[model samples]
Target: MERVNVVYVLLYDHSEERILMVKNKGMDSSYYTLPGGAVEIGETLEDAAIREVIEETGLSVELDGVLAVSEAFLEQRGHHAIFFTFRGKVVGGKINIMYPEEIEEVTWMNAEEALKYASLSTEGNELVNRNSTIPYVLRGKVIHKN
Candidate 1:
């Protein structure tokens, strides 16, 4: 069985009413999502989150807390992917799109605008709504009932 485990950072700067987001091109892309990606082999979850942020957005961030965990099996892709979303605080570094193929744009979107993006995943909404980590499994297009 194929599987992909990843981390997503939700770095909220409430003072600016902004959230760090990344836009990816192509069909496989999630469009606009938090700054994060797949976890490297042998990498810890928190480390993956921190590393992904820098790799994708060129910003150094520290994990504030865990926000949510979502697991979904993409039958079409023939793999199971687990997403670990965390609350992150920018510590240093400038923002830029380091990976052009994977990241098209990086911006501090207004909190409302970020949430309003059409591509915002269901799991993403749940994370912001509760303002905390939620672990849930999604089987295909529908969320799996616990």
Candidate 2:
């Protein structure tokens, strides 16, 4: 199976009340998710997160630290992905959809509101809400084994 590395950035506004998120255009339907994408060859995890956030949301950010690590195995797709979610703060740029093909919208929402859109956002919000420094880990689960 192919192994993929993905990076997501959970950026909070100045008040630390809202999180930056993106609506991704998928094959079946659009879904809300943190600003992120696959890590390219020769790129560090931090760089990938920063680049992805900029590409998807048109914002520059400085990552405070890693928030969570998640993994998933897709047997039918013949791949597994390791996701690195980071806590970040916006430093520059405005909110804009830089890439319209993959991303449908960019917006900020409070943790409670964001929970209705994406489940993964829950982990990040929990850490921020509780002021926890430990990173959460999500073990990989295989849908089917051949």
Candidate 3:
């Protein structure tokens, strides 16, 4: 199966009760996902996460460490994706849609309220509830590499 690596950043507000997320029109017309994107060639996962957040949400953040990892078999997209989720703090920048062309909207949501969105990314939902440890690794099914 063709493989791809991506990163997901859980950019929490200083109070630690809110999350930075984006409504990515390109990925799904109806979902809000964490601020992150693919790891480009030569860029570390940490750097990619920071870059993606700034590009997508216009916020500069400092990563704490890996929070969780996940794998998804996107049959429709024909790729097996490995997602590295990082926990980070917003250090700078104001709320703005940096990539308005791609991002439908960006917002700061109460951690609990964000979880209620039916279209929120599954991996994101899972991680929100599993904050007991750092770098929690999630093993996904090979199913179809779908």
Candidate 4:
């Protein structure tokens, strides 16, 4: 059986040209991604997103809506874990990288810029790969499955 995981992408207007993203820590130095984590037992997906975002970025989000749901089988921490990607919006609190051990740096970038930071692995490609159904622009409502 494969492990299940849930992660969220925290997005803000950023003047309609860019969105905030965090560089993951200890993942080959180029593992930058949205702020999110795995869903704990007895916890809802939404709750996990909020908790993960806060833990990773020290920021509280209003969760504008579900951006996408991604399921990928990959080896992490010595096990194959399925990953779920959820996108949300920040509503309050200051932006700070609290989990330096897991998060190295935070940067805001547009669609092209975001993709540049994504990993070439299937996990990263799946995230950047979008279909017609998923809006190309980084605004409004959207959902994706992989």
lDDT winner between 1 and 4, please give it: 1
Write one digit per residue (lDDT tens) for candidate 4, span 1-146: 45767656646455655667787766465577767777898776667878888887777886544445545556465445544454566778787878777787776778557655533245444543432123223344567988
In model 4, where is the ten-residue run with the lowest total lDDT? 129-138
Candidate 2 per-residue C-alpha lDDT over 57-96 given as tens digits, one digit per residue, 9 for 90 to 100 = 9999988777778789968778799988788889999988
Candidate 3 minimal-lDDT segment of 10 residues? 132-141
Give lDDT tens digits, candidate 1, residues 1-146.
Answer: 48999788888774847888899785755588888888898777887888899999989997767676678887887879887878778989998778898888998898888876523477667667677654433233556698
How far residue 7's Cα lies from its native spot in candidate 2, in Å, is: 0.5
Task: Give per-residue lDDT, candidate 1, residue 140.
Answer: 38
Ranking 3 against 4 by TM-score, winner: 3
lDDT of 2: 0.81
TM-score pick, better of 2 and 4:
2
* Residue 80 lDDT (model 2): 97
Clashes of each: 1, 0, 3, 0
Please list the residue runs of candidate 3 whose C-alpha ends up more than 4 Å from where it truly belongs after superposition. Answer: 116-146
**At residue 121, what lDDT does model 1 achieve?**
72
For every candidate structure, what is the RMSD over all alpha carbons to the true structure, in angstroms? Answer: 7.8, 7.3, 7.1, 7.9
Quote the lDDT for 86 in model 4.
49
Best by TM-score: 2
Each candidate's lDDT (Cα)? 0.78, 0.81, 0.77, 0.63
Cα TM-score of candidate 2? 0.82
